[model samples]
Target: MGLPKPLRLKHWQDFQATYQQGKRYRGMYLLLRVLPDPRLNQSRFGIAVSQKVSKKAVVRNRIKRQLRAILLSQRPNLAGGFNVIVVVLPSAVLCKYEHFLRELEQLFKQAGIMNHGH
Candidate 1:
């Protein structure tokens, strides 16, 4: 399952706000930005993959899908009321899905965004 609408960061303001005020987690494949939002009371997320990462749209979408899959699988572990965005780096294309998931999970853990004792 994918992230629901209420759990998605779509508006430009939301993205901008998260970018400006959020804490950052740098990983091998993605850079995560997270900002706490009290109004929502639930977490929202956005995925960013620039053309610079891949000239082909197919490759970009594939990367996005991989990321969304990782996030969806770990949804229960994430805390609520936060806006998170994952920015893909060019190196992401070369990595295996399991490797990417592991790196992302580690970063989320380090950021304290994921609930403990999972």
Candidate 2:
């Protein structure tokens, strides 16, 4: 399973917009591009695992799955209306679920996106 429909950033254009217009936060294993849209009532996310991370489709898919799981668990505490793109780095290929969760939390806090609000 993946992120709920409403919470997933499905369009290529939306992904482009977020990449071009969002503020970037870098972590050791991930990169976050976030754009806050006050008009929205909920946040949406896109996870990117490039070929550089792994040549095998299965590896990339597993990385994406782990990230989606982390995001789902953290969703309720996240602020609303942000378009967030999580780009997986090559360094993440060896990371575990708990490491991914910790990195995401640190990145979110660094980006000032941990508060609850409308």
Candidate 3:
């Protein structure tokens, strides 16, 4: 399973917009780009795991799956109305869930998207 429809950023245009307009934050294995989309009541996310990260589809897909799970777990604590794109680095191929989780949490905090009141 993947991220829910509402939470997934599926369009290329949206991806481009986020990439062009969003603020970027870097982690050890992930790069996050965030843009405010006040028209929506919920946040949306896109994940990018390119060939540069892993030439094998299995490895790339595994990374995406782990990322989706992490994002879903963190969603409740995140602020609404932002479009966030997560780009996986090549180093992430060797990363475990705990590493991704910690880095994502830190990046979210660095980006000021985690809602403490939650």
Q: How many residue pairs clash in each candidate?
A: 1, 0, 0
Per-residue lDDT for 14 in model 1?
A: 91
Off by over 4 Å in 3: none
Candidate 1 residues lying further than 4 Å off, grouped into runs, are: none
Best by lDDT: 3
Best candidate per TM-score, number?
3
lDDT, candidate 3, 22-79, per-residue tens: 9999999999999999998899999999999989999999999999999999989999
Q: Model 1, range 22-91, lDDT digits (tens) per residue?
A: 9999987889998888887778889999998999999998888888888888888988888999989888
Local accuracy of candidate 2 as per-residue lDDT tens digits, 1-118: 8899989998998899999999999999999999987877888999999999999999999999999999999988788898999999999999999999999998888777787451
The deviation in Å at residue 16 for candidate 1 is 0.7
Candidate order (TM-score): 3, 2, 1
Roughly what TM-score does model 1 have, to 2 decimal places? 0.93
Q: Candidate 3 local accuracy as lDDT?
A: 0.94
Task: Return the candidate ranking by lDDT, descending.
Answer: 3, 2, 1
Identify the runs in model 2 with alpha carbons over 4 angstroms from their true place: 116-118
| Model 2 / residue 69 / CA error / Å | 0.5
TM-score of each: 0.93, 0.94, 0.97
